[model samples]
Target: MNPVLKLTDVTRIHGEAPHEVLALRGISFEAHPGELVAVMGPSGSGKSTLLTIAGGLDRPTAGSVTVEGTDLAGLGQHGRARMRRTSIGYVFQGFNLIPALTAAENVALPRELDGVAPRRARAEARKALEEVGIADLADRFPDDMSGGQQQRVAIARAVVGERRLILADEPTGALDTETGEGILQLLRARCDAGAAGVLVTHEARHAAWADRVVFLRDGVVVDETGADRVDVLTGPGAR
Candidate 1:
């Protein structure tokens, strides 16, 4: 089967000639259905830039990014926004939930924005919350929940619509180890159900949950290995 997300020779440059910095350089990557690929690297290595470009939140200065078969550049601004709502789900390291909105409402917000009826959107949101194992907290506001609970709401929102591609950047960064592992388990389950996933993480243990691991350095893919062999990148004295 074809990849749900593909980035081909993608390059992203910030600023202009005199002050520009390359955030990504001739990088190509893909995440196929039923797969979870983890991108790992040190600070300034372009992991987050790669994710934003793939999710259409940022455009590449060169090359192409395709999601669910549509090239992002060809989509234009509005088109890309539409695609983001219908086909892609992004989870940020910081939970970007609205404090005033309850868990269910926050999860439903995307579908509602997409023109789904309020009642139907709510039903779907609750379903997603249930899938994330937090249905009981549907009415709790972000401020009223624990960090783990709030993050669960974030995950529910991301997968609420059966989005074809899921992009997560340091999704477990804010939680305790146990809570973070729980979050990773949820992501793994989502990929097992067929939504392609790309996780950007710096922790080797977290990356181990993925099917494959990609190592980046200075905006380039320096190496890649199956999750089972991640030690190739993080083994003792391997760096």
Candidate 2:
């Protein structure tokens, strides 16, 4: 299958030479459409750095990242930003929702920013919310929902458009195990619908939901394992 996302010998460094610390070193990987891959590591393992570079939020110091076959290195800042806004969906651990906006409104923010009509954006947002099983809460504000519900809204918002790639950073970190599992199921459902996803997480249980888990240490990929035997607490079959 053709890859939807690929990272080739990618590296990111901080500070200057001598004092420079490498966040990522010669990292390479790929995710095909309908696949869910996990990035696992301890703190400071460079998982976040890789995700940011892949999403175009940060530029790599070296190597190349291509999404949907287009090399990100070739795009200027503005072009990359536009591509990110349109082709990729990002879900952060913090559930970055607008406090004042209702669920539907929050989901509509991206389309609105892209100059989509308010009515049509709301319709699309409703569909996304429905997909995540949060349609009933469409009029509720973020503060009015539980953490799980809020995260679902965030997920809905992330997938509401024509986005094909989802980059999730510790997506379920804030929720309890049960809630986190629900979130993972939602992501799986999205993948079943043809979107590819890369999740950065420290929780082995969370990583289990991925088809493959790439483990990172220091600034490099040290190991990768298939998650077929992984249960929710350790492997991919976790409820």
Candidate 3:
């Protein structure tokens, strides 16, 4: 089967002329269905750049990004936006929920925008919230929930439909250790159930939830390790 997400020789450059900063350098990667890969790197190492490119939120400066065998470069802006709503799910450090909308409505918004009937979209949203262990909070607005609950709502929104690839960038940045672990568990479960997941985090313990870990340094992939051995590659003592 084709990989859920693939990046071939991708690069991203910001700025112009003498001040240009290379955000990524010929990075190549693939995340298959049922696999969760963690991307580890310090600031400016291209972790967030890679996620944005994969999710079609940003264009690559070179090479291509394929989602389930469909080359994103071939899609026009509208097409790419539709693809993002239907196939890619992104979770950011901040919960980007609409403050006035309840959790279920927030989760249902994307589906609704995609032309899914409001009734069905809301039903799917409820299921997603339940999957993330927050069904009881479905009727609550983001302001009414705790930080963890809000993040759970964010997760529900991301994975609400048949979204095949989930991209999380520092998703746990605001949560406490236990809440962060809960979020990781939800991501892991989603991957196990067939969606491909890429989690970008600097914490070794957070990366521990992934099946494989890809380490980046100065915008280049410096190491790749199986979950069992990620410590040797990312641990402070490792190099």
Please list the residue runs of candidate 1 whose C-alpha ends up more than 4 Å from where it truly belongs after superposition: 227-239
* Clash tally, candidates in order: 0, 5, 0
lDDT of 3 by residue, 1-239 (tens): 57899888888899997999999888878888999999999998989999999999999998899998999999999989999999999999998999989999999999999999999999999999999999999999899999999999999999999798999999999999999999999999999999999999999999999999998987788888884533324232134
Clashing pairs in 2: 208-236, 230-235, 230-236, 231-235, 232-238
115-179: candidate 2 lDDT, tens digit per residue: 89999999999999998998899999999999999999999988888699999999999999999
lDDT of 1 by residue, 1-239 (tens): 78898888888899999999998888878888999999999999999999999999999999899998999899899999989888999999898999999999999999999999999999999999999999999999999999999989999999998997999999999899999999999999999999999999999999999999998888888888884534334321123
Question: Per-prediction RMSD in angstroms?
Answer: 4.2, 5.3, 4.1
Kindly indicate the candidate among 1 and 2 with the higher lDDT: 1
Which scores higher on lDDT, 2 or 3?
3
Worst 10 residues of 1 by lDDT: 230-239
By summed lDDT, which 10 consecutive residues of candidate 2 come out lowest?
230-239
